[model samples]
Every structure is written in C-alpha cells, then in structure tokens.
Target chain A: MGRPSAGKSTLASHVEDQLVEAGYPIENLDGDDIRKHLHPDLGFSREDRRTNNRRTAYIAKLLNRNDIPVIVGMITPFRDSQEQARDIIEDEGEFVQIYVKCSVEAAEERDPKGLYQQAREKNIEKFTGVNHPFQEPLNPEIIVDTEAQSIDDCVDDVMTQLETLGVLDERLDDDYSFSITRSEEQDITERLEELGYLEE
Target chain B: MGRPSAGKSTLASHVEDQLVEAGYPIENLDGDDIRKHLHPDLGFSREDRRTNNRRTAYIAKLLNRNDIPVIVGMITPFRDSQEQARDIIEDEGEFVQIYVKCSVEAAEERDPKGLYQQAREKNIEKFTGVNHPFQEPLNPEIIVDTEAQSIDDCVDDVMTQLETLGVLDERLDDDYSFSITRSEEQDITERLEELGYLEE
Candidate 1:
C-alpha cells in the first residue's frame, strides 16, 4: 500500500502477471477496481476507507484460502486499517506489506488520474497525500522507492523480496524484459496508463 | 442459484470440497457470506438484491479470470440479475448455470434457516421463493433436483454435467464418499443445518 500515483498499481500488476505466468492462481486487486465494482457506495472518509480495506482483506483471505494469491494495491492511508487488513489476511495465509514509496511532489508530478491536481484545487475531498494524510507503515515487510527506481526495477525488487521470503520458487523468477532503458520504459508505462491498463 | 433451503450451499460445499481435493484452485461464493463481508449495508430490497447479485457476479468474474473457478450459490431471484451475471462472467470465462431444483414445498418443509416460517409470519420482506418470486432459468447448463436426489447424487450429477460440458477433464473425476444411505445423509444434513452450515 502507498500514496496515490506511487506506482502501486503498476508494480502490483507486473507482479500479478509474473505470478500468473508462473502457473500460480493469482489476481490483482486495485482500490480503483474494488471501488468501481464492490464498494461503489463507499466514500473517501477514514471510516469508509477502513470498511473498504476490511472488505478487500476479507476477499483476499477467501482467495488465499483457495490457493490463490493476490497482489492488492490500495492507498490504505490509515495505520489502523492496514493493521486490520494484515490481521484478517495473515490469519488465513500470508500478508506481506510492501511499501511503494514516493514523495508527494513526485506523485503529483506523475498524476496519472489528475487526482492530485484535483485535490490541490479542492475538487476532491479526502485525497490521500494531498488533502489527507498517508501514514507510512511503521514496519513494512518490503519497501520499494518508486521515486528513485524504475517501475521494472521496483517490480524486480518486490519479486526478489518474495523469493527471499520463499513465497516464490527460484524457477518462478520472472525475466521482466529489462532490456529497455528508463526512458523507453517510462514511454511504455505512460502509453499503458493512458490506455487504462495501469489504473483508472 | 436456487431458492433458500434448496440445498444450494450444501451441494456447493460438497462440489468445492471435491474440486479442492482434486488439487483445483477454486472457492465457494455464497450469498450469505458475501452479504456478511462485502454487502453489509445492503438490505433485502429487490434493488438491493440486484446490486448484491451483480457485485457477486463481478467478483466471480475476477476470480475466474485469475484461473480460479468459483462455485457461487446465491438466491438470484430475478432473471435480469442472472442474465447480468452471465453477461459479465461469460466475457472472461465459462459460465455454466446449475439450477438446483426443488419445489417450494420441499424447501419450506426443510426450512434450514427457518426463513420460510419467518416469511410466512410476515417477519421478513422480499424473501425469495416466499414473498418474492424466483424466476427459473430458461435454459440452465445443469439441473439437480434436491428433493428427489441424495446430496451425493446431486454432487455426482453436477460433476457429470461439468465433465460432459468439457469444463473438467475426465481424469479429474472425483471419487466421493458415498458410504451412507439417504437416511443417514439426511440425519447429517439436519445436524449441519442446525449448526448453520446449510444456510443462515
């Protein structure tokens, strides 16, 4: 979990794709998708966010119980909500908290949804990292600084961490097409984001 | 989907158990479970039921897309809701609707949740197959009559239907424990129903 536009969705999607190719039954659960499909009634209030996170965690537990891992990307702004999600998920399977770190300045500059701009202009209320606070996880299992690292590098970092944790076998290690440089990767990322492949 | 107390959950749980034992990545999505976790705010109104059914179908589609087959047992009381679920799920993966058939007389007599009694006393509103109508599917892929068949028989019928549809490999046919007679099975079913395993 991380701030909006911290590259959480992109990194999670890459991880989901890799796991799928590895023959693992897994899915990517993004906050946007969940809000659109499952929690349309929920707002951006802290209480609503907690409810949404709890619901997502419940679904994740169900999936994990069925041997289906999930890569969840959500701007879980509250520490209590994060803890609640961890508790619910860890009871059934594993819960790895991966902090996709990025400064608010960098995130606003890369505002894929124009949400940061809207929040700045007082168009959206309770927007994380802009109008609202995003409590950094006190003790995350893994951390990837999206501001400094490329998206592919961030994905590689997560994949390596999962392998180190023995959650994934060495044979499942993904060759993430890292032949392209940062500029080319950014170009593709922007195109994909525009096409709504990255996020809403 | 079927009327309440039609043994939908019992049949679904058996099928899910068999599939899991066969090393398949699958889970059962029951309406009661979904209501508790994802739709706590929703009521028993017709519009609410439609929303709930749509949301459950959306989650089923997500699970199916991730290579995880979902056994959904919801009292989808309307033809529109079923069609909507079919439209959404069929886009990504196969959607074989299995009509768990049982006369309202049999289901009400069973009264797993005592819901038929409540509905009869006008204690519950919008209860399907009681106060509300249940539109039977026009052409379901499979049909299992819960009144005339044993639970084991119903499970076998479903498995056979799935195999016939080429949804499951012939080699993956499961060997269910059919040691008990119908009377013994009914005793177990009654106990499970009292324990709230059948429905709630």
Candidate 2:
C-alpha cells in the first residue's frame, strides 16, 4: 500500500509478471479495479476509502484462501484503512503491506498521469498528499525506497523480503523449491514459451 | 446460473471440491460474494443486480485470463444481465452458463435458508420468483434437471456438459490429458491431502 506515483503500480506489475512467468496462481488486485469496476459510484471520501480498503482486502482474503497469492497495489491513505486491510487479509492468509516510499515532492515531480499536478491546481478534490494526508504505515512488511534506488533494485528488495518471510513459490502444486532454478541464458526464455497463461 | 434454493450452491461446491482435489487453479465467483462482501448496502433492485452481475463477471474474466476456471453460481434473474456476464467473460475466455432447473415448487419445498417462506410471509421484499420475475436464459450452455434427478445426477449432467463444450480441465498449466488420470479410489483421496491449498 503506497501513495500515488510512488512506483506502486510499476513495482506491482513487474512482480506480477515475474510470478505469472513462474507459473504461479496469482492475481493483481488494484484500487483501480475496485474504484472503476466494483464501486464506480464511490467518491474520494474517507468513508468511501475505508469501504474500498475493506472490499479489496476481502477479495484478497478470498483468493488467498483458495491458494492464490494476490499482489495488491493500493494507496491506502489512512492508517486506519491500512490496518483494516491488513486485518481482513491476514485473517485467511499472509498480508504483505508494502510501502513504496517516495517523497511527495518527488512523486509530484514524477507524476506520469499528472494527478499530483491536478491536485496541486485544485482540479481534483480530496486527493491524497495534497488536500488530504497520506499517512506513512507505522510498520510495513516491506518498504521499497523508490526515490533512492533503480526499479530493478526496488523489485529485488521486495522479492528478497518475500523470500525471507517464507511466502515461497507456489503454482498448481508445481513447487519450485523456493527460487528460480534455470538461469544461464537460453533456457529461461524457452521455458516461458512452454508454460502458457490462461488466455490460451 | 440458477435461482435461490435451486441447488446452485450445492452443485457449485461439489464441482469446486473436485477441481481443488485435482490441483486445479479454481475460484467460485458467487452472487453472494458480491452482495455480502462487496456491496452490502445494495438492495434487490434491477440496477443493483446488473451491477453485481457485471462486477462478478469482470472478476471471473480477470481470473480466467490468468488461467483460472471460475465456477460462477449466480441467479442472473434477467437475460440482459446474463448476456452481459457472458459478453464480459467471453471477451477473455470461455463462459459456461448452466441452468440448474428446479421449479419454484421444488425450490420452495427445499428452501434450506427459509428464504422462500420469509418472502411468502412478506418478511423479504422484491425477492426473485416471489414479487420479482426471474427471466430464464434464452439458451443456456448447460441445464441440470434438478427437479427430476438427484444432486449427484445433477452434478453429473453439468460435468458432462462442461466436458462436451471443451471447457477443458485447467490448473497452473498442468496439462491433464482430457480426464482425471488416477481415479482408482484410494489414490484420489491421498492426492487431495498432499496438494495443499494456499492457506498451508
């Protein structure tokens, strides 16, 4: 759970691709899915944000119970909302609260969607880290220092933390004994082509 | 797929167990999940039902694209809502729409939740098949005659239809050659206990 433009979606999609390529039963839960598809009528109110948090966490919990690990990229703005998500998800499976740590100035400067700029210009109301507050998680399971490190380094840090936590590599009972075994050039690429995603 | 107390849940859970036991990547997308967890405030309105249908279908499509077969057991009361779900899901993957055909008489008699009785006593408002109409799908992919057959037989019919349609058994790319490989009784039971779900 990180603030917008803190490389939350970037880090999420990268990790998600890695998991998919590895043949794991994975799902990427984003706030966008909840906001756009599930709860489109909802606005950026505190109550609405808390509701979103609970719903997404519940979804993750359900998926996790069925043995699917979900990588959720959400900007849980408040501590209460963050705690609520953690509590809901951890009830069934592990909830890895990742803080994509980036300064508001850096995030604002690097805003790809210009959301930060919009917030600044008063185009968007109740935007986190502008009119609204973005509370830093008191104790996040993983903290990716996006401002200080490269994307690869940030991803590696999160992956390493995941390993340390014993989340382990899982798929359709295709246990990989922890890490990616086939490295050394040509083999890994060929292996990816062999295993297909669900669309096929 | 079927109305309330039409043995939809029973059939869904049975099929779900079979898939999980065989180490398949599966998720059961139920209307109950949306109504209870995601949109608790939503009432038994036409718009609410359609919104619920679309949201569940979207969730199913996302999972299906990632290679998971979702058994969605929803009482899609209108053909438009049913068509909407099919369109959303089939955009990415196969959608098997099954009709658990149980007459209102049989369903009311077998109302496990006493929902029908409540609806009759005016305790529940806008209940499907009570005050509201349940428009059957024009042409469902499968129809299990729950009124005529036993639960086991009904399950068999649905499974047969699934196989016929080539909605082939899928898991984490673990290609099973069209059927359950080792089903000699003792071996199957042991296999389920070994291939642990996500909670483990």
Candidate 3:
C-alpha cells in the first residue's frame, strides 16, 4: 500500500506475472481496475475509501480461500484499515503488506497519469502527499523504494521473499506439467456452452 | 444499503430468484458470501466497508457488462460510494438502489447472527446503529420497509420496479415456452470432453 503513481500496481502486476509463470494460480486485484469494474458507485471520500478497502480485502480473502495467493495494489493510506484486512483474512502471516515507497519528487517525474502535476496545479484536490494526507506504514513486511530500485530488482526481492515464506514449492512445477497435459480449452468451451453462450 | 441482519441478503436472494424465474440471467453478490469467499482479508471498518462496497459494485458492473443483472446485498453506509458505482456502470438508472429501510428495533428483532444482542451488550464496536452511523438514503429508487411490509409485498414491489425500468418485458407471458433440445446437452458434453473435463 502506498500513494498513487508509486508503482504499487506495476510491482504487484510483475509479481503476479512471475507467480503465474512459476505455475501458481494467482490473481492480481488492482485498485483502479476494480474501481472501474466493481465499485463504480463509490467516490474518493474517507468513508468511501474505507468501503473500497474492505471490499478489496474481501476479494483477496476469497481468492485466498480458493488457494490462490492474491496480490493487491491499492492506495491504502490507513494502517488501521490494513490491520483490519489482516484480521479478516485470519490466515496468519499470509497477508503480506508490501509498501511501495517513493519520494514525492520521483513520483511526480513518473506520473503516468500526470495526476501529481494536476494536483500541484490545484486542478485535482485531495491528492495524496499534496492535498490529502498519506499515512506511512509503521512496519510493513517488505518495502520497495521505487525511486532508487529498478523493476527487476523489486521483482527479485518479492520473489526471494516468496521463496523464504515457502509459499512456492516443487508442487508448482508438477502442477504446471500436469496443466499442460490437461484439456483447458475443452473446459472453457464447455463452460461457455453451460452459460448459454453456445448452442447445439 | 442498511445494517447487517436487516434482511438485505434475504431480500436480494428473493429478488434474484424472481429475476431468474422470469427468464433473466441473474447473479447475486451477497456481502457475507463475498467476505467468506472473495475477500477473506477484509474487515468491517469504515474504510474497509467502503472498499467492500466498491468491490461489490465492480463485480456488479462486470456482470452488467455481460448483460447480467447482479443483485448485491451490502451495508453500503455512504452515498458517495453508490454514486461512484453508478459512474462505473455508465448506464444511467441501471443501478437500482433498493434501500432496505428498517428500524434498529426491527433489525435487532430479526438478529439471525445474534450480532445485535452482542452490540447491545457492548461486545461489538461500530455496530451500525448502536455504535456507528447509518446514512439514510436521500432519494433511493425503492424503499422496502421490512418491519411493515410482508415478504411477498416486498418481492412484488421489486418485480414491479424491474418491469417499469424495462429490465423485464412485461409483454412476455409468464408461461412463455422455449424448446430445450436434448442435442444441446450432447453438444455441451462433447465440448466439456474437448476441454478435458471428461475422459476421451
């Protein structure tokens, strides 16, 4: 969890891709994508933010229940909210909070949406570290400083952490091999038919 | 949006049943089910609640995009989140915000989870009305008073609203028939086998 344009989404997506490549069933819950698709009715107020946070955590928990490790990327600005998320998951130490730290200067330079510039120009209000307050993480399990670190380095750090946690194992390799032989294409077509997307 | 134990889930399930029975593809996104299955890590804090609301909306929008009307039951306490959800769907008036309006007394009386009793005993903090705030809808599309109205009445009201909103074509007879050819099942089975779910 970090401010917008902090490379949180990028980092999480990279990690998800790596995990997928390593043959683990994974889901990346990106905040923006979710906002557009899931909770379009909510706004960026304090109350709305809390609701958004809770919903995302609930999705992560669901994926976890399905034995899928979910990598979530959101501008979760509150420590209390994060703690609440951990409590909801109930699977102790499974919820890894990775703080993608970056300086305001660096974030401004890398503002893909030009949001920081808009915030500075007073075109956007309540921008994190500008008009809105961003509560820094007191003690996140992992910290990746986007200002100094390369994407590859950040990915490597996350991969190393996953290995240390023993979340990935030889079973993943076996699953990949098994999946290649399994008929996934047939399953997709059958599912499509069951949903009435296809006819006789 | 209303308090937990306010019959939100029960009502949504009923509505979904009616829609499906009317030959419409329906999906129900219940808060409890989502928390248990999708977002195991999320809790019921202000921020967390907002996130939850947003995520539900996102899923609803996705279903809507696929021409499926999703019925979601959540304690969305804030209006901003609801508005955001509308924006995400982009289709004007597609989001039917049915405020399951019920008094705290009524909710407590129907306390299926014993949550209200706990809240009254101060065992739980941030209990919708007992501890936390619940913003009443200023202009909800439909208001179902569970305390005064019968389940049948409530269901009828929703069905009428859906019809009025053109969600259900009233002209279509209740006994409208569609041919269910056995060959369709054979085709689906063949597709499933191709997908590798069935043995060749």
DockQ of each: 0.44, 0.40, 0.21
Ranking by DockQ: 1, 2, 3
- What DockQ number belongs to candidate 3? 0.21
Tens-digit per-residue lDDT, B72-177, candidate 1? 9988989999999999999888999999999999999999789999999999988888788899998899999999999999999997788678676522334233
Query: Residue by residue across B1-200, what tens digits does model 3's lDDT show?
Result: 77777788888888888766656666677888877755667787888787877766766664554445677888888778777666766652277778898899888998999999999999998888889878887777788888889888988887777666655652243334543322343477689999999984
Candidate 2: clashing pairs of residues: A67-B198, A198-B67
For candidate 1, the per-residue lDDT at B77 reads 88
- Strongest candidate by TM-score: 2
- How far off is residue B189 in model 1, in Å? 30
Error of 2 at B193 (Å): 20
Per-chain TM-score of chain B, candidate 1?
0.84
Error of 3 at A31 (Å): 0.9
Using lDDT as the yardstick, the better of models 1 and 3 is 1
TM-score of each: 0.80, 0.83, 0.50
In the range A1-200, model 2's lDDT, one tens digit per residue, is: 77889999899999887766655668887778768977788898998888888887887887776767999899999999899888888899988889999998999889999998888889999999889888999999899999999999988788778766757433322554445432321265666667752234
TM-score values for chain B across all models: 0.84, 0.84, 0.81
The TM-score measured for candidate 3 stands at 0.50
All candidates in order of lDDT, best leading? 1, 2, 3
How much of the real interface does each model capture, measured as fnat? 0.70, 0.55, 0.40
